[model samples]
Target: MTDLDDPGLLDDVHPRAVLAELFARQVRADPRAVAVQHAGKELTRGELDDWSDTIAADLQAVGVRPGHLVGLAVERGPVAIVAVLGLIKAGAGYLALDPDLPRRRQRALISAAAPVALIVQDHLDRLPTHHLPTVWADEAGLGDAARPEAPPPDDDGSRVFHVVSTSGTTGSPRAVRIGYGAVLNRLRWMWTDHPFPTGAAVLIHKSYGLVASPWEMLGGLLQGIRSVSLRRDELLDPVLLTDAVLDRRVTHLYLTPQLITGLLDELDGRTSAAPDIALVTSGADTLPVDLVHRFRRRLPGATLLNLYGATETASNTAAFDTARLAEDAVTVPVGRPVAGAELSVRDRHLRPVPIGVRGEVCVAGPPLALGYLGDAPDSAERFVRMPDGSVLHRTGDVGRWSADRQLEIIGRLDNQVKVRGYRVVLEDVEAAIAEAPNVTAAGVHAAPPAGDTVLIACVAGTKDLEIAALRAYLRERLPDYMVPSRVHRVAALPANSAGKLDRTRLADLAADAERPVAARTLTPRGPLQSALATCWEELLGRGPAEAEEDFLDAGGHSVLVVRLIGRLEKATGVDLPLREVLENPTFGGIATALQRRAAR
Candidate 1:
């Protein structure tokens, strides 16, 4: 068994120091170090400190006080970073609101968080118009005025540092209140266990609304390391992101599995020199073993670490370094509990299960977040008091200790769905599909209720995959009931703003594919129609597709549409508008639009 009771490791974490204090210490240590870089601009530690201090003073002057919640709806950049620091220095916790999310959802989150004031980027029109007192972050501290002399508010590490919302995949998003003590412990453990070089840079490209974003944005700054911030559009473009990492000399990266997979694909077969990345941490979703192998092969010099935890646990409780994984390793273990954290697998009754027995993964210790904000019942239910006086947060994730004592996550307890009459674990099916030839990633979801709920599988691969062969491959391993009844090919699985797999969107797509649509017997007439039909058939894995068939009904999603558009543009040399193609999704509509443009 692996022993995690290390007194030295526990003693390293400063119990009283909060994030604000730690950042202040870094500023004092090296004021000239570059703290944040975004788009061609950079902010030195001293500049960031003064700007945030001035903003903090401005916030304090407008009735913002310690323990107050302030809403931050700013685009990703230096301004957002400064706003976060400013709020922390003012002794107020921030509620991050992503500018890309729907205005209704943003308003809903703001209402739920009930922040006293809002900090927004004035140029972003997507931000909702809130009635709260507003502070324009972009213009707050841009002037060369004198820095404030007032010191930051005192913090004992018990105050709420931030309030972030859950992914809301299963239901409405829950606001989680994370205290400074929890975040401080997590940061301390990360710095101690995986310390980066002095001038190393980290990327902060994740949506600010996510619970995981703060670690990316603040982790490097607190240690006096440069953090490169990318806009959402830049983050979506793999080539641009790779260029940024290589150009900015990013040595460390914390990304979701989905995002990392895309980056690895972009980096594959490149002749350019690989970036000097020292560490790449994967979290926010399950890290696939295939991805681990790919990372080992593609960038053998860098170490890949799989971190496991949730929003309630301040992002990660345990981490596994995939440095010396065996060639035949099937699943990646989430590793032992980090310093200042205790992890145990428990049964339904919350009793500790025997080693190697699959059960719910429960976390205890200082790294655990306070609880869900504004929901006392949920807080009490998830954050249960143990008989030993330690508060244990039940992670709904199902996992077990391996023979070597590392935690191996099986799947979510809630992911067990009823297919026909038999119960099926989606992750199990996804694993089998992912092992198939050419397949890189896979997602399995059960279709919504009808007469009978059927299982659907979505697979993304380097090459085209045959559904019949995939089903046959699954039949050899999975049981009859476990085999997915329907399969869809996608360029990549969809991810939410948080970078986690959007399972809700996947299920909706699967359900839409299952819905029968009337097929019109329309054949290709012109060159445009012929090209459109060919591309559609190739993308959807159905040849000789009718022009009148709805693209979405034939298992075509936005990702696939983008690929289809690329193929059509290459084939005909006519510039096609993405919005036009999406608005008129049918092959006939697209072909007509293309013909009209060509005629002009």
Candidate 2:
């Protein structure tokens, strides 16, 4: 065992062993600094560290021992991160669970995790009592736990600490164990390189609030800075996200394109002063070049950075500084690996491919996680041993190195997509679509649903895809991406009873872009509102759709609809359209302003 107190230990090189040791020192230095803020609440470093200690002590009291399996429901905010740190402090590795999970599905995960003690908020009595022990993480419970005495620490980075659930492409979620050695390796790399400068704090976008950023959670822990944790769903809601940023005066933050789109659209109404934020990071999904340009145009002072990583590799293994975005967007590489991590392009044979050659992404570092748990034996084969006998988790994502030795994400080698930054499987979208009302059967494709970041589906009639409505149905069971972006209703889908789509035919449908079916939603009209809405709905190919509360915010592509006048004439029976919809927009004063054209 290693004691955390050895001087200059972390300065030279440290491992997961060093992470646990830094706990007290970090607290001592920044005890009063704000650690997290959510729903009008704030937690400080001393408070979180103290709470983590208690959580660790409490779990130990409940028969949780070193290496015991503990199931942690991954939720947004301070409590979630504290719970995970508590597991490590208790000498147990934790399994992450998403709170929004359906009961039966959650039950299956609980069964698989077989956690000795589960940490969860009792807010929803939704999770049924399990055969295994349970600990409700309410206010009273937290207050009663004891503070953890720091463990005798070491610099050994190889200790196991967590089991992350990753559903690659589609299947049951596999738990990937991330060891201490790996965690330390990753945190060291991040802190040593792209730190937010000492004393600078960062806000978690809350989309990934469940998992701490190497910079936000651990990096803050190790480096004596603050990671302002915002509530997850609340952040998704624009007003709340903006308020959180301003109120907290966040200096650094990370978000995806979907989020940036919303934030940028909503920023004007929220506050005149942009929060103190300087660095805005994005990744884990495609960063649209247009959106990147929009941010620079709007917030000329803000720095946008793109970070890339996966569960297999610790969060933020590589980052592309957004400053590079002004020059060239698409060609921007994922950039140099953090401090000690190594990223490479490997060929099918698992051999390192030459720079600029496309290959499988392989990452090796102290922060890399162990292989997936309880998986098919063959899955283990993907773990390749390097010449020095080190292990690298194979990220099936395809990428290439630039002439400058930077890694660039090409796309997924599998059939998965991240919508709004959440990884979604196309098959899952199909299954959910199959469950839609009046939907006898369906097939989903990554086909740009009417050019929006949505799944495309062909339903059973001339019935156009009621996207907003269908989304409501899918939201009941599946995550957002599983809902098809557009549902096409054809009397008969070209499929065999053995049931497989004639993808060739579907591609043809997408090509003609004939999805004129409108989504079902509260209608907007007047000449300008109605005409603009009609063109948008048609060009995008589906909607009985209610226009967005904010037009520009809903994702309008000016280039995609150059024929705005013709399309509007075809749908709304009126037109005075200019170069684009932006020319005139609103129900109060547009064409139909005189006669109230009812919502269809």
Candidate 3:
């Protein structure tokens, strides 16, 4: 308790300090500096400030005031940055509506946020229709009028700065409210510890819908460093992303482990020198030691850090530098708490556990977010008030402190499932599978409780690794109840937009794997049927059980469905609409529809 209150634990930034004020100082210091770069255009600090001030005036005219929440549905560009700065200048927090997500999901988030107004990028159709007053980012008349002279709204650090939607893989999404002070603390700590050099640039490639986007886009800007924005299509192509990093002189890059692996693979194939990045940070998922070693080999000069936090913690609380890690280290510790933050491993009773004992990882500090926006019960449960008047966030993650004070994360408490009356940790099973020869990655899921429940696993490995051999390897290392009953081999595991493992998609694949083998041996009837079936098998990593076997039942999700449709159209030389594939979700149904369309 005393450690929690220690003055040294606080960040150097004043509690009353806000990002808007800090950014203004940077603008005044160097107005001619490039503030943001996108596509082939650049915006200087003075120009950006003027543009945002115009937007702020427009928002204020519409009755937007301090503490109001505004919806920003803009794509990644200079205009998007202007919208964010304008929202803060107007003293209104922003809720970014990702244009790539489904319209329904965007609508759901807007409903939860209940924002007073919406700022949109022209021609963006991914958002649902709303009655809120709209301001177009790409409007021809924008910034045409003279800039208003009204002073910027005052912020004491208690006002909400933004709202981030939780992943909601297991349930409905919840909006997490973050304050100006919380994020300012996070950015200040990064600036102090990993100082950005002059002429340095940060690649703002992550989706604005994610919690990490704010820091990725603004952390460098507040320090007068340039931010380079990448379009979604460019981000998906490894070569394009690598080229952008090199061409833009990006000094700081942050990505999840999955995306990092892709970038490393691309670098391995290149004859050119690796990009001269100063710092590379990995977060949003576990950083595998193998990946860390690959980064070390690929970018020897750059510092590699593993950051650990959640949407509720302003994106980062602890960081570990893998530069000096030993060769034989099995796991990477998340390292000590960042400035202005404190970490504790506590038991179910909210009592702190001794070092080296696993418990729920709780974070307490100024970086902690306000809480869930609309869900009071959930906010109360996850954000607990300690007897000392300090608020701590229960991360639901299992972790322990090492003898040297490093934090080692175990697995999630919710991932614990009962199998054959014995409790088992899914991550432990995945780790055992990953240890198998040539197995690159693994994901495990537990089937719904029935008369006899079972465990399923999906592994991505070399062709030499057979399912029989993998099962035997698991049996040797894990208990009988812990051994997965069914295993599926794939080219690679799927990842979400944020570059983290898509657990829900993995569970869908596992469910498909759980079906009996005899039922999955259907024969294609014609060339059209065979081509469609081939595409389905390739995408799902398994064949259909019957002609009527549903595509979704065969582990196909929304993201996979799009890929499937694209492949089908290419292979068959026929135009297939997305709705046609979704409406006819069965192998027989889609094949018949495609044949008819081809004949017509």
User: Which residue pairs collide, candidate 1?
Assistant: none
Which is the winner by TM-score between candidate 2 and candidate 3? 2
Poorly placed runs, candidate 1 (over 4 Å) = 1-18, 25-32, 125-129, 146-153, 167-171, 415-600
- lDDT values, one for every candidate: 0.73, 0.62, 0.75
Candidate maximizing lDDT: 3
Better of 1 and 3 by lDDT: 3
Order of quality (TM-score): 2, 1, 3
lDDT, candidate 3, 144-180, per-residue tens: 7435444444455667778877533222346788887
lDDT of 2 by residue, 374-457 (tens): 663435665767779898778777999887777888986656676646666666566656766667766665665423465566
**What shift in Å separates residue 97 of candidate 2 from its native position after superposition?**
1.6
Which candidate number maximizes TM-score? 2
Compute each candidate's TM-score over C-alphas: 0.74, 0.76, 0.73
